[model samples]
Target chain A: MPSADEIFAGLMQGAREEAAELWEEAKEFSINTCWSLASQLVLVGQAFVAGEFTKAEVTKYLETIRLQFIATLAAALMKVEGLAERIVNAALTAVRDAINGALGFKLIV
Target chain B: MLRAIVVLLVVLVVSGCSSFQLGERYDKSLDDDLSAFQIEAVTFVASMRLNSGTPAGAFTSDAAKAFYPKASGTLSNIVVKAGLLSSRQCPINGIANSIGLPTIKIGGETIAADTPKTVVTGNCAVVTLLALQNVLADLEASHRDHQKIGPIRGQLAIDDINKAVATTLSGLRAKDL
Candidate 1:
């Protein structure tokens, strides 16, 4: 067994690699989230079975194939939660802008 | 197989934990620069307003000065620290890895070969925003004596909060996720 330091070091590397790989996962996650229609859903189901997913999953699925399934599902979970921050920022900005404009003070400028 | 799964589950749980504070614990250099900037900006405009001798009336006509540091020594400290963490990618379950209580320890009670942990920066921006708010609130509370608030100074603090929040928002991007 790798020492705990070795293990942690590996995880960090995996995360870095995964962060870069997030783009493909993001596209895949987006497709899954959209679930356009029956045809699209079928394709995603296929992809899920095939083990193609976000970088976070790469770390997760590494444990096992079942873990991989778990990883992909969590990636989808990540997508919803991930996009949420974008929405929050947009909302905050909207609120901030409105207040700043009203107050005639540039809060962020 | 059962043992592997159980052990792997433990590792995964630990890895999942780091997601919050994947970044460095705290950037001391950034703190120093930020505090210094705050003191300078606060002192200057504040004293200027006092000396300007503007009449004590609502909506004074003095042109307000804006105080915003064009750069953050903070980014340098954060990036440097993040770079270091980036090198240590292997994940291990540690206590600090939890939300805001950053204790970087890894337990090796049970597991397969070496297991690695992913990193997270946590809600640091939120923490900073809250800290700033508390400081401002406390200042307001303490200064009830004279009730002195320079329009410029007040505006600067609000601007500071907005800027900090914006920086924080950028980090929430999926790439950072």
Candidate 2:
């Protein structure tokens, strides 16, 4: 039978891999959102330079876009943070379960 | 090995089971309402794009001006509905200890330290809806000022609204897990 230390090390390794994957997902989401928002802004800048929008209209539109991006970014970050918390809790639970199973009793509670 | 297990349990007990959180129970009604709104919003923007150069679809035209009040009213209803859901549903609690409460800031204003998680988890839907409202208003203003929304700007607005709604819906769905 595998010893408790060895079982724990293995479970923790799995947990670390899981956490890293989640982190990578979060990073990618933020990057993509930034890219999308920047692209829209570039379009606005181009239109402004082309004399399509007056200065006041451009300024107002930019402010509105800023607010829109802020809310979207905030919600995205919240989703990431919430998922990370859940992953941590799950990892701990897995370790506890593995330890208990190895000892043939409720060893960790 | 036994000693290590004991130490791990101690750490777990100290940390608490699910005290660290920023999520609430999944509300299906919230999901339905937002999804419905998304269709309505995108469809409206698409219509505006199609009719950009027509006098009948002009922002200042009587027909176009009539849609604003109805759209704004629907959004206001959504904001209220989401607020009720967030306030009513509580996140599951495994252990009653909070380790790190992250301070959150949006648009340069810091949310209150004590309620950051709850606000983010609960009020995030409301916040996003409110932001969408602003976007709608901006669209209205742009249409009025410019006399019509060009196809490019119309598509951009649709894309923006779609993304915002998708992110919030996904977040709300995640809370179920």
Candidate 3:
């Protein structure tokens, strides 16, 4: 049978891997979002330079974009927060189980 | 070539204006909030360490305690970055609407319109503030009880935060500017 320490190590390793994977997904999402925003800015810029769009219009559009970006970011971060919480819970549980197994007592968390 | 030059100059000038600057301010504020959240998270983990006596200059193996704090930090960083990414959605849609551009399709997902911009932005701020408040509350509770946070309860709090944020983004679609 694997020692409690060994089990703990394995669990921690798994948690780390899971967390890393989620972070990567989040990063990719961020890059894609930036690209999309950049494209929009380019299009808007083109219109304004061509005398098709006025300064006031550009300002309004930019303000709207700014608000939208903040809202979107908040939502994405929340998902990451959920993942972190799960990882922490898993770590805590692993610790509790390891301690219980070693000490032979049901310690209340 | 002349058109391209004009377009480039326009992009610089427009993006450098007050409106774009205000957006940058909001982005900074959001980052500040996330940083505060991260500090609270780390403190919470430290409190857990104290209650459990598994590490933090205790008798428990140093390796185990070391693992948690590092894990917590990494998780915090990832969540903040992801949140920043999600914030980009609103701006993309807003720009599209302002210019009468087509809906932005990204990552196999079509960005559409759902809620009013003011309403959505207001809700986003509220949810973020609430999440921070929740973290503060949890820290206080942990200190008062003199115990590590229960895993189940911690998970629930996290779920609550996530739900609050998700609600803000739900039903979002491109609107006509």
Candidate 4:
């Protein structure tokens, strides 16, 4: 059987890869949201200036858009945190498995 | 002998791992509720799109009023269940607060950004459901204000709400083991 140190090194490498994946996901989400929000808000403003939407209508729509942005950001944060938690748990489980394997039994279960 | 050494190693590992409890565990019911809600919400928005610029889709019309009660009930159920599953304090809140918005300058005018009080919990379910409630509120408000849903706005609303729910569902489905 492989030594416990070797198993840990392998597991930590996996965790590092997961973390990098999460970072990429977070960046993509941020970029998309920023672009969408800015472009949508600009359109809303242009429509208002063109008299297509009333003052009250524009106000309501802006509020809706703001709330939507918040909601979207919150969802992204939850996803990032959820992925982080998974990485942590996976590392711990790997540690447990390594110990059990080293013992030639399920000692850590 | 060997048993004692193994026991010590196991104790060390467990103790080190236990304190890092990160987010709420997956709840099958919450997942089901969200999926059901997403379908209902998307269908409702699509219906609005189909009937855009018509009285049939007016907020004050009987057709629209009929959906309010059941939709609100399901949303409230989701919010309450998520709250029950969450810890009193969630780590997401802290992270959000730390990443608070920076002030922006527009046309040489300094506009102070609003504080980042967006996320209130580490529980993905709670974070998602509450945001969904706000989106629904916006939909209701817009419908009431505009009298009828427009095609473009209806499409946008569908996209916004769908994205919000879909991301969190992806998170909740994270592998448990």
Candidate 2, B24-127: lDDT as tens digits: 44578878888888898788778877887898668877757777887788778877876765553223111111323322222343333332222223355665
Model 1: per-residue Cα lDDT over A1-109, one tens digit each:
2343454445445545655867564554344322322222232223233433222322222222222222233223334445654454454455556655877876443
Give the CA lDDT, 0 to 100, for residue B51 in model 2: 82
Report the lDDT tens digits of candidate 4 across residue range B3-105: 7755654575767654234455667898899889889888987897687678888887787897777889998987788777656554445554455443322
| Candidate 4 regions with alpha-carbon error over 4 angstroms | A1-27, A42-54, A60-77, A102-104, B1-21, B94-124, B175-177
Q: Candidate 2: TM-score?
A: 0.61
Candidate 2 lDDT over residue span A1-109, tens digit each = 2333443455455545666857565555545554565556555544554544455555556444544545565466557656876775676777667767878997556
Ranking by DockQ, best first? 4, 2, 3, 1
In model 2, which regions exceed 4 Å deviation? Answer: A1-27, A49-52, A84-109, B1-23, B61-63, B87-122
Query: For model 2 chain A, where is the 10-residue window of minimal lDDT?
Result: A1-10
TM-score of each: 0.22, 0.61, 0.28, 0.67
C-alpha RMSD for every candidate: 25.1, 13.9, 26.7, 11.6
lDDT of 1 at B41: 44
**2 or 4: which has the higher TM-score?**
4
What is the DockQ for all candidates, taken in turn?
Answer: 0.02, 0.13, 0.03, 0.14
In candidate 4, which residue pairs get closer than 3 Å at backbone N, Cα or C atoms, i.e. clash?
none
Fill in the DockQ of model 1. 0.02
Reference contacts preserved by each model: 0.02, 0.20, 0.04, 0.21
What's the distance in Å from true for residue B57, model 4? 1.5
Provide the lowest-lDDT 10-residue window in model 4 chain B: B100-109
Instruction: Give the whole-model CA lDDT for all candidates, comma-separated.
Output: 0.36, 0.61, 0.41, 0.62
